[model samples]
Target: MHRLLLPIDALVTLFVLTAVWLGVSSSYDPALSYPVQLGVIVSGGVYLAVAHGLVTWRIAYVFGRLLLLASTAAAAVFILQFAYQDYVEVPAIIERIGSLTTLLPNLNLAWQHPNAEAAFMIGTIPLGVVLIVTSRRWLWRSLWIVCTLVCLYALLLTFSRGAMVGLGATLCIAGLVLSKKLIVRVGAVALLIGGIAAVALTSAGSAWVLSRWDLYRNSLYVAGDYVLTGIGLGDTFPLVYSRYGLLIQVPQLTYPHNLLLSVWMGQGLPGLVIFLLLIITFYLFVRRVLRSQPRRLFHAGWLGVTAILIHGLFDSRQYIEVLWLMGHLFALIGLTAACGRLALWQPEEDVPKVFRRYFPNRLVAATAIAAVIAVILFNQELLAAWHTNQGALAETHAELNPTLRAADREAGFRQAQSLYQQALAINPVWPNANRRMGNLYVKAEDFAQAVPLLEQAYRAEPANIATIKGLALAYMWNGQLEGAAEGFNLLPDPARMAEELLTWGYWRTNEQDQPLLGAYAYETSQLMLPGNVSIPVWQAAADAYRAAGELERARQWYERILAEAPDNTAARQALAELDDA
Candidate 1:
């Protein structure tokens, strides 16, 4: 049989596949090679519709409106989630909406991060703006206006400096290209310059700008080292950045902010080229079509796409933190690629005869098969993440999240345990899953199960405080005094765990009065506390050593404490007792 797609489609498909191949090969965790996969699925489906002339204007219109409505709802949710504030200076209305927003679960409905949400708002708000201008019904127009206003407010509230640049670009492009007046065109240029200046001069702007510079510099450095094959995707970039580059302390500053650089980081240079070629080919195709067959849909796409492009220059994290935003961006790309058909023909334009005969059926079958293969390949990691997330949500209400699951607490706990077991079975070395599952067993006082998982996590991230603390606690409870001592020694600071460690130390001390493990905990606490030896930790250390028959070590500590505090009765008494011994 003849091939299904046209030459253009075949070329685009080839580029996409090539990019995917490069992305997967170079990535540390290819399962999160998000850009290529999402693009293929979304763009391919939209292309099939367009190439077959299956997309009706009415269908396109409905989809656009639904997208606008969803953006409005999501914006509303983001606005109402005031408590988190992401440590940003939010509007005063945030305080008032706390009770209202608390009604919803924190189940990924805007965890209050603005990086992806800001870009999404930039992309989706244009649809509402278009509908507001085009809708004939007053009711529909009014609703669209409300949606646009809400999205605009939410966009500003995100305080994403990149988003502001994108908005400025959107407005300037619309004024210059869409308007007839020369005055408007000139004003657009002036407005853009002013917006840039404002963003650059905004309070705290200089700090972030400098931070971006650091990121860019380090990204370039890293890119040079792994020029042919990148460090990889997912947590790989962060890991590399921390180890080899100028790593900043900001959370989820995972990907390089620029889209091209991010692709290069994950997929190397070849993948970046392919990705650009694929996008350039399609968008240019849309541009050429619109010159002959102009329509509202194309204009709407231009406004949204312009925002993505301009914002992407300054900030592009299209993966990991927000999968839904990846879909949203790809959908826009697909829609832009396909919109010309709706304008050109009456029901829908007739596609080339070759594709018309076997277009969707053959394509869908091929895609399904590929997807099945991919699922099988990625199932272990994918399924493990899914189960681990559910297990975490069930075991404890998420950190900084007030909402808890509505199920019975005991049931939730048991379910968490079961889910974690399944996840670890599938991905035995997944650090987070192992840590959480180990914690669940620890909570049940099952020390045997907890030790190995904690040990695995410790091996993966030795510097991680939570992992070390968990491991230390498990060792202490399990009566592995040496293991417990090592963990406590490794802990940078045990100020928070001081009381608990002190109690454990005293309880486990031998008849000779020396703690089998508490000495290290006490010494570490003494080092970390503000007044290094101001607390009673020194006294406790001395007593534990004296009780352990370490007379010389106990005598030294007692003398040091007396050096700091001559009036310290306890140290004086201990020194007297040691001397008597």
Candidate 2:
């Protein structure tokens, strides 16, 4: 039993960590994605209990045990692939099993670096394995502590807000219950560290972690639009895309920053209830273990759990690898307490009445152990169920997309407009959903509908570079020159000024302001893609110059445009018109 448990715990921990990396790395694909998540959750706790048993019995099974468990997991994945033919992701499966690869940037994932999963797994699991193997060695006794600090530092570098919050919460819990002397020392250290971290965070760290907070907030608002009663499970991606649009084209609903909220949105009240119950159960179990056991190890577990739970508040990996490991830790404590109680010296009179009456005559410990093992063994089914739930959601969106496309085909403008509205019904951040919706209205020469939607999207995502550009276009479509200029100011990068100026000039058609447009255009063209695009700005300036009867300036501007874009139809025509005039 001890041998069985140790490896299970290690694998569970690894699985939990790996799942988070996977989710952050990929899109929200129910057919293939969420099982890896569910596996971590279901197995993390059970295997953790087993690891605790190994630690208690001083077993030596970390390597072979972990290998066996990994094999089991790989086999399960293979079986799942065979079972759900449609959902099987061959490349993903190969990659997942292949371990860490190189760092690669994925716009969909919050962490910009590639092979983040490999880094986290390599950094974290060996600590557990080492702790388990060297349990009896005095030198290795402090291994867990050392590994934890290392993991914490590594986690910090990941700049994952969820991880940071979770780790912080865990430390706070440890500090709260620490013995008086230790508490004082820890408190002082904490204060100093906190002060420094705060200054750094305010200055630099915030850039590392919350670079995407605004995007997260947008997902929340968008989720409410489509998920009236929840969009059903696995519906986040399709719902987000069909409802919101390309601006938010990345699959988000599956792994929102707030993991619990994503579950609530996907699975509704039942999912939320299940999720809450799981947390409460783990908390109760861990609290019981801490109060009853009173060991320094238990205290360490408390800190780890606290960090995870607290961090969970800000960044959710509820169904991911982290939570799974947390579950294992909770189970290990519970198992340790149970095993310790089995050897308790019970006085005849002091024997708890409850134990005599309700506790079993036989070793209930074995039964409990078996139950935990069964949970680990049967975890595959739970993963399969989670995948099914995800699929239902994808189908819901698949069903909606065709209808949206059909509506679009009849009239591009009307389709874009209506699709935007329907998308907002599911995801408020359907990217330029509202922008296109408004633009469609503009194209149809219906400024009224276009204005409000564009305004709403702009306000919801004020920092989004694209949304501001879209709003400016909406204003241009409505011939609102002043409004376009105001919208343009919202952009963070002045480099976008060329596009903004073009929209602005189109709106006002005022030759005098062409210099304003020309200046911005020249600045943008000098720095950006296809540098020749700036030549048009000169041509527009020439048109304006001609209108103002500044013949020499107009000629110069026209000559510049012709020099860059020799086939410049507009510039050539303008020059001819100028010569004729």
Candidate 3:
């Protein structure tokens, strides 16, 4: 049972789980909270395994190798993130490393990766690497390659173009590397590449792929601007996407299309240097292993790691459990090699000699484990401070997001106002919070409070249609006719502004171009209430048209009301009264 658990890539699987948890733990969503907790339990198990003299065991070295590989991969990811800071949006490194509460349910869903599902993809990396390493025999190798193909196929489901490209390249490289003969290698590579190209041509050729090229070029140009130093990782992706691909709403967003630039943006030159060095170390280690002992285990691990490195260039699987697991598998391969060289106990030294050979390492591991506990505690304190007032605030604001939409539908002006206040207490300058608050005030006929917040939001974001609309609505509600006109004119389309002005103009000038205003009102009423406009809105609009002397248009609207409710006194009386006028 123990053997079954140990060599079957269980350790790597657990490590990937740890990374996944790290990613998941970053989200504060209630839906992901439970999954985060499970991730925590998994991480704890791995930690426990390390504490229980596992690190010193033969398998312990495997764990260490994986840890080292993971650290290296993380460093690589960080470097790429900084390099393409203009395109890729990286989260806080602390968040990437994860938190204790990462085990909470649905916590990580908030983290939207620009390219792919980071946590899920990262999880696959380690698992893939481990599978490759363990599958060196002919059958196992074939199975492993097939597994990799399947994984990449699954990656397409993520709709991450970068991941797809990277996976394709990695597979191509793998076919070449794993080929037993030159002829087979050449044939396989050609066959696969040609097959893929044919499929791409048949489906859509380069049209789908080329459309996003400008974004990539822009990202490269922006990354080059930073040169030796770049913007922080977390800031880059959002900035790039907002600028280049705002119009294109695809699953693989326009972000730091290149991972190398992302890391450069975050940690700058030193980070880049560290990242490059880590990659070099992996290459050197692989070279050394292949030269000294070209075992199948080593070969598989090396190729797997290479694939991840290739993939990391354009995609970030840092948050994925499988990626981390694969990294650990490579580490395990290296560790097994290292331990074979150390030859600490010769399998004959019993448990005491085993203790003698590995006790010092165990002591250090124990000490480090204790320090980690202290750090966790310290982090918990910091998190508490950050959320001291924030938790209540989040709750307040959280209620508003969904509630405002409902309020808008029902025209529940008062309820909307309360929700906006609740949201403001949580986050005063929250964009939607301010907008919704103003809208609510407009609905309640409270123009005074509505104007200031609406203006604030509009100034901050002039292109925001909702803000402009709210501001104009407030002016209209307050009887500030000219102010309403000015506000309406600010809209990009004059025709829309003219139509709006016609309605309010009718209310102001009782007989000025009444026909035009009435026509506009009738058209608007038709659009707003396809079936009928019996609501107060139609009544007011009709009155505005009548005041503007648009007799025909007013008659049309009044006739509409009477059509809906034949015996409705107001409609009948209004129609008769219009005739008298």
**Model 3, which residues run further than 4 Å from truth?**
1-136, 153-162, 166-445, 462-576
Off by over 4 Å in 1: 1-12, 29-54, 84-110, 201-203, 247-252, 344-581
The per-model lDDT (C-alpha) reads 0.65, 0.46, 0.46
Q: Write the per-residue lDDT of candidate 2 for residues 105-174, one digit (tens) a residue.
A: 2223232221122223222333343354446776654644454443443343344445544444444544
Give one digit per residue, the lDDT tens place, for model 1 in 1-581: 01222533665566456445655555444555555455544554554554444256677777788888898888888766645555354445644444445555454543656767688889988888888888999999999999998888778767678888888888998897778899999999999888767767886677777777766765775464455455455555665554333222234456788877876766665566556655555555555555665667667776787788778878986645434665666566555544654454333435555334333445446657986997799888767766775675455322211344444566777887888888889889977677777766766779788999989977876755556777776776675756765676665444545555665566556432437345655554454444555537778778777766777878888898999989999899888876786
**Residue ranges of candidate 2 with Cα displaced over 4 Å:** 1-136, 139-169, 182-189, 192-202, 227-277, 294-297, 300-302, 310-448, 453-470, 497-533, 538-573, 578-581
Q: Best candidate per TM-score, number?
A: 1
Ten-residue stretch with the least lDDT total in model 3: 242-251
TM-score on alpha carbons, each prediction: 0.55, 0.51, 0.37
Q: Local error of candidate 2 at 204, Å?
A: 1.6
At residue 237, what lDDT does model 2 achieve? Answer: 46
Q: Which of the two candidates, 1 or 3, achieves a greater lDDT against the reference?
A: 1
Worst ten in a row by lDDT for model 2: 114-123
Candidate 2 yields a Cα-based lDDT of 0.46
Model 3 Cα lDDT, one tens digit per residue, 374-446: 6687654333323322332232223322434654534444444555565566555554556556765664557
TM-score for candidate 3, please give it: 0.37
Superposed Cα deviation of residue 100, candidate 1 (Å): 9.0
